[model samples]
Target: MAIDPKYLMESYANPIDYWELFSKSGLSKFPPCVVSVAITGGNQGKESNPNLPETLDEQVQQTYDAYKEGASLVHIHCRCPHDPSTVTDDPEVYRELNRRIRKKCPDIIINNTVIGGKWSRNGVMCPPMNVSIPARPEVGSVDITNYTWSMMRKGRPEYGRPQDTLEEMQYTINKQELEHTLSEMKKYGVKPEFELFDIGDLQYLRDLIQEGKTDPNVPNWVQMVFTPALTYQTPDMLLAAIRHMPKNTVLGIVATGGCQYPFLALALILGCNVRVGMEDGYYVEKGVLAESNAQLVAKIVRIAKELGRPIATPAQAREILGLGAPRMEF
Candidate 1:
């Protein structure tokens, strides 16, 4: 049969019919992209924003309000009730906060933090503590056969440490710490949102999965947090990091300070989810501090809508993110 020029022109001019047909036949439903509101980070002080929730009661109330406003997920970092400057690694605190939020908004996904504040050389907030141990016999054996192995398995096996002489190894939270945190979250049916500050963090997550530390059915959501002072927090850099992310992993962008909104905008445009709040950036605009976490989320929602993107609701987000039953009844 001879190809018709007129037919070719028609196909080119109106591809919508073909696209819709293809979409219906092959594409799974595109879950509405979720917008997570990070109510409070562990680092920021009350001086930064009086509206920032510091105490457990304040954190719970703020998280509940955000969920009511339209946040499907609340990214949380528990601060010491007595000291905002200190980051608590206590699973008890996380459990309490998680319980409170679940009671308030049953369907809202609670994302707990694994990476605490950056510890200083004197064990303060600057250089994070280093935790390294020899890979288990199985991990080492698997490295020999696994095609995906990338770390130096033979060298002085350092797990989570900055490669610097001046870097002092502070208190290292081991597998016990991880188990404790995971156990608490499991109690409330809350999902952990891992924060990968560097490639090492990504490797650690893979290890967790391999060691059966994390459940496969549980949706593995990760945030690629970029620190401009420590690492390049640019669009290209963020994209490069995403390229290496594991499959079935949902990613959110979290760039500190000036690069925060810009990276978030990039994430939204790229059809990925995002996290924004006082934890990532204090300012809603240049030189203007955000009054609340809701304000930040509202701003992102506005931008997403303007770009013709729909914000994911709690149920829709759960489906998209592959979460199990909601922790509490809605």
Candidate 2:
């Protein structure tokens, strides 16, 4: 069957209504796929994967390597220099990190985390909100939903730490934090990446758009992070997420742990973008540890290539996400 060029372009523009046309179209009709790599997560560090970058220098190098391997967008979490175990919310730390990163990967989209880092401000644990200042990252993640993150590592000898362990932490971003985060993003011209965990979060975003709290003009970057703790990694869940997404959404899928590879591949087939890195999963494959973030990125790049999906460069990603030119400079 021959596909019309105008119709295919329209399908890319009107993604919500054109899902059938885009997904059913041949390889020639596939839109450029943006590959985002979350270099390091706030929860686990060298303990989970020895290669996980913790210091400022390590992160910059890892990011540059990933960018070379076809990842156009980089999601970052700055670890407190003083306490490497905990994530930092210090604006100065984020500023310095973003500066160093820009020096290395100039055009790659720098996305700082609002919910990844857990630090104490008055002896009370809190997520970072000052990530946009000074750094003014091109993108910053805003977690819309709250849930308990429960995980257990049992007899995983491949990892550096193989001890059987269980962790259950209540993750949240309160109303005040949300207001401040949104205000800061608007102030700095940073694109908001909505971190969603379930179907309800999509509704919450919809309500925000209707309330005029969120800018409806800008395309919504909805990143659905699928984990068994909050939402299962399954086709039904992914499809439901796509079905509930609001109009003008650039959907990105992330599955925690071992499901990352398969989940992202499925996302590619459905004409959605994908995220990969140690933050999401440490292993490149089952029982095979990933040496660096670039390795994970290369794996996905190969998958997208095999599926006939062209990888989006940083410049292309900016256009796809409806972002302006590089805002922050060193």
Root-mean-square deviation per candidate: 12.2, 5.1
| Residue 102 lDDT (model 2) | 85
Pairs of residues clashing in candidate 1: 118-126, 119-126, 119-127, 120-124
Residue 270, model 1: lDDT of 55
TM-score, cand. 2 = 0.87
lDDT by residue (1-330, candidate 1, tens digit) is 222221111221233643553356321222345888777764444556678887888888878766766678877667765555555656566667777778788778766554422333344444221110110000000000111111111111132232322333232345566666555545544455666666556677777777876667644667666775445777777666665665546666677777677677776655467777777777889988877778888888777776666788988776666665665432
Q: For each predicted model, how many residue pairs clash, with residues at least 3 apart or on different chains?
A: 4, 0
**Most accurate candidate by TM-score:** 2
Tens digits of per-residue lDDT, candidate 2, 133-171, equal 547888888887877665654443443336866756666
lDDT of each: 0.58, 0.78
Worst lDDT 10-window in candidate 1:
135-144
Model 1 TM-score, 2 decimals: 0.68
